[model samples]
Target: MKRRTFLGSVAAAGVGAAVAPGLLAPAVAQAATYKKRVTGADLDTNSRWQVAGTDLGIPYVLENGSIGYLFGDTFNSPWPEQQNNDWRSPVMLRSAVHPGEAGGIVFDSAAKVAGNGRAPEIMHNGHNGIGIDNLWEVTVIPNDGISFPETGRQLVSYMSIEHWNPGPRYSLWKSRYAGLAYTDNGNDFVRTNLKWFNDADNADPFQMWTMQRDGDWVYVFSVRSGRQDGPMMLRRVPWEQLFDPAAYQGWGWNGSNWGWGRPCSPILNGRFGEPSVRRLGDGTWVMAYLNCATGNIVTRRANTPDSAWNNEKIQVTFAQEPSLYGGFIHPWSGAGANELHLMVSKWTHGPAGNSTAYHVSQYVGSV
Candidate 1:
């Protein structure tokens, strides 16, 4: 496929812009609409989004005129005490977002049992007890289909079983399972015991990311983020049986037909960051994630949901930040031929000279 440089950065050596069907038309139109690259300004420059040392921001719009973001490794206190203490807590930040507001988010609740198992949270190792063995990261979405119960809350699903105790660094040790949860007022999210997905080993531990619901199925876009931060894995279950493990099936993309398979095959290539995916008005799927190699936000597009994706463009790079990690697309609303909104974050420990901190910041761009 023929291609040209996007501005000056996205060349063939960088982004893989294809000239296939449904790919070239968008590029020519985008060049005419946007200046060079699609970049968004910070919503508020006065104050950054404050929370415990956290990342993997999953943002969604609520029914009560507010925005909610579910995050992972979200601490209750400061560093060392943050991830080392209650490292597996999944927390939320809710706010009435405005353009020029100083501070962000109105209410930030304490960490609760967002993704713990049915058993007691305290795990007795014969002598001492531990409770940080449940969910560490999550991806929540609203039930957009008809005939669904109006819980005044959005339907939530998350990944867990991150064993952090009796270990060296407390890295996310093997994802356990994915389950369901829900909340309305933005805080007080309740997780259910029904685990709908899991893998026996770390070969392909699915880290649940962005979710989309069509007619009767809820399509989940996840990554094998543990053993190998590989391509995006797709899974779907009937809308009525989202919490039932037996109701789900990992899509087997075998070049020809997409069928059921365990430990779902990778759809894209290269070790990746935690990703967020959504369908555009033109039936193309757009996925945005932090490219670990470039320390920049990268994206890819696919003609079909379970097919080979093309045109991986490096969207934006945070040059001043350290540990500039992955990006998660704001799942509710943020996309166009020449513009999109995203929540990207970088990690921070203690001090910095003159750089961004450990807060999830928003960016809008035309990628």
Candidate 2:
């Protein structure tokens, strides 16, 4: 994902980069207010997704049934003729269990790239080969099966530009907020954004997790910002306090932030992203996420979501080919039985592009 390539395409297309309008319009804003309480029980895995227009990629499910996803679409918007190289990234949505119920907000990237260039651009721009588009947010209401509302309302939208030879080249663009939703809109929802690390010469992909370990409180686990040193940057925020505007900043832990106790192996050293956290019936929290290019799914456990985590282990390895990108884990019930399941996307070549699928594996007890 070179910065020059991304910005060059944007400039070449001559599309004006404009800031997003304020919140929802009056009519839609009024509609946005809901008296009905949307609960976790309203979300289900058995529900299917209808093809909401495949502009670039396929959509997959996030932990449990709270989120759905699509990625890698390559067509330019506002005008279909100007096609950039097919360098699409991940897109996700909030979903409901019942057929025609309303879910939460959706988030996605708006960038593309092709061919090789300079290592400088790649390092400086943080995976320069990939370009992100202005992030968009959508509200979903199921229509029978997988069919959803075709149009999505805009939340925070912005594009990234790469500093270049002439001036700042619009290399990478991003929306202010990634599409994430919470029920109360109080402390349950947290606001965060991506920032480029010029000193590290790479972009860190941040992952967010919300888990309930003991009582009713939810714990927020953020992978903070990642460098080459591995996914050691870990932070915990009380769920009830995260939504405060000022509390959202500086959540990363300070210190070594790596190592394993006697019972656990040394934590892998590298960047990590796409984290999924779930609580087992016995009251243990299990966290799983990808470690950089290795594409290995690693797990860690903690008695309380905010307590120090331990027992880091590799759950699955995709050494042969890295088909599993941006994955999530959840418990699924079917035919009177329930088991742990993983949903991942298979990157396709040629015209088909990409599609997501689910893999079911029994929960053999968490460490």
**Residue-wise lDDT of candidate 2 within 143-206, one digit each (tens)?**
0001112112111111222332222222122222222333122112111343322222323333
lDDT of 1 by residue, 1-367 (tens): 0111011111212222222333222111111111211111222211133344455456655655455555554332333233233433354454455412333233332223233211111111111123233444222222111124345656665555444222211113344555566554444555666654555544454554567655677777776434233455678888778657787788765656557655465555444456677665456577776554444676767766666666556665645444555455544433454345566655544464332344555555554
TM-score of candidate 1 relative to the true fold: 0.63
Name the runs in model 1 displaced over 4 angstroms. 1-53, 63-66, 75-88, 96-153, 161-173, 184-186, 196-201, 227-231, 259-263, 280-284, 318-320, 332-334, 349-356
* Candidate with the greatest TM-score versus the true structure: 1
Each prediction's RMSD to truth: 9.9, 17.3
Candidate 2: misplaced stretches above 4 Å? 1-216, 224-232, 248-269, 306-312, 319-321, 331-338, 350-367
